[model samples]
Target: MNKLSRLLLTASSIAPVCLTLIFIGWMKDSRSLMIYSAITAFISWGLCWSLMQFAEYKLERSHKIIDSLSPANKEVTNYFLSYLFPLLGTDSIAEKKEYAIFFYLSLLFYICFSENYNFNPLLSLHGYKFYEAEDDTGVGFVLISKEVITDIRNKTFKVVKLTDYTYLHTTDRE
Candidate 1:
């Protein structure tokens, strides 16, 4: 099944369990508004899980598309982004700030707020590895696992078109 379908299935299955837990105070032994709390928790968990899955699906798909595009298309993508984010534009600062905040929140939400079952590329690749996001260059810099990095360097996973940006894998502290 597709990623969205899998995510929806997982969420539908888990929502009930979470609702049940909230309804019965599974761990806290605290009294909840039972039906109301259960409903809220159900909605919250289900939507959150679905969104997590959606992001993972998008990221994976984006990587595949980026890896397959031609050099001309890469140039087009860069040109579009550059024009879209003109530095001297009146709202550029606001746009940049908004994107930064959104990115930071996504990082926090996916990394810290999510459970182990939630999908994350960073976690899947390597734990405790650092990564950098370069917007202007249209590349996500990552400190991937050694095995993955080796594969990348060996051309197993080709970056189809790297016009202006590419991740630099570094382990040196200094």
Candidate 2:
């Protein structure tokens, strides 16, 4: 399904779970239960927001690098976050403020109903050591100062550049 549908599904799926907790609290007039529910919601939504922020930060950092190199190659400016999270396409990237607002709203909804649901942490969802081939044409991939790409035989990730091979979407190399 699309991002909107997936988002809706996530919100809908979590709602009943959280509402049930709220309902239990109401039935028993238990402040503790209510507080617990609230905490759970906050944590769940907070983490989600943090993850988005982290992704944004990564994109922005990449953007700066792209911009710095824009003088020589103007096309790099077109390399957007959509390229990273294809679920959100070029259109969404254009209206970043709107997307951010909607994402916040969605997180609020998800949090309200996220209390009782069990979800894996972000780390659990994807392991590190993700590799994408350097495929930015001649430029290949630019290495981040602290980033290290392991050399596994002939195939290895180049830390500095986002190669098409390592671009994640193109090759599924990660």
TM-score for all predictions? 0.23, 0.28
lDDT of 1 at 102: 43
Reference-based TM-score, model 1? 0.23
Candidate 1 on 1-174: residue-level lDDT in tens? Answer: 234333332343233333333433433343432444466445645564544344433423223212221111122343233223322332332323344234323433442323212222222333322222333245433222222221222133212121122222223222
- Once superposed on the true structure, which residue ranges of model 1 sit more than 4 Å away at CA? 1-31, 56-60, 64-174
Report how far residue 13 has shifted in candidate 2, in Å: 6.4
Clash pairs (backbone) in predicted model 1 = none
Tens digit of per-residue lDDT, candidate 2, span 73-172: 2222232221133233324423243443354355545543432112222322332222222332443332222223343344433231122211211111
| RMSD over all Cα atoms, model 1 | 16.6
For this target, which candidate reaches the highest TM-score against the unseen true structure?
2
The reply for model 2, stretches above 4 Å from the true place, is 1-16, 59-174
lDDT of 1 at 60: 30
RMSD list, candidates in order: 16.6, 16.0
Q: Best candidate, lDDT-wise? A: 2
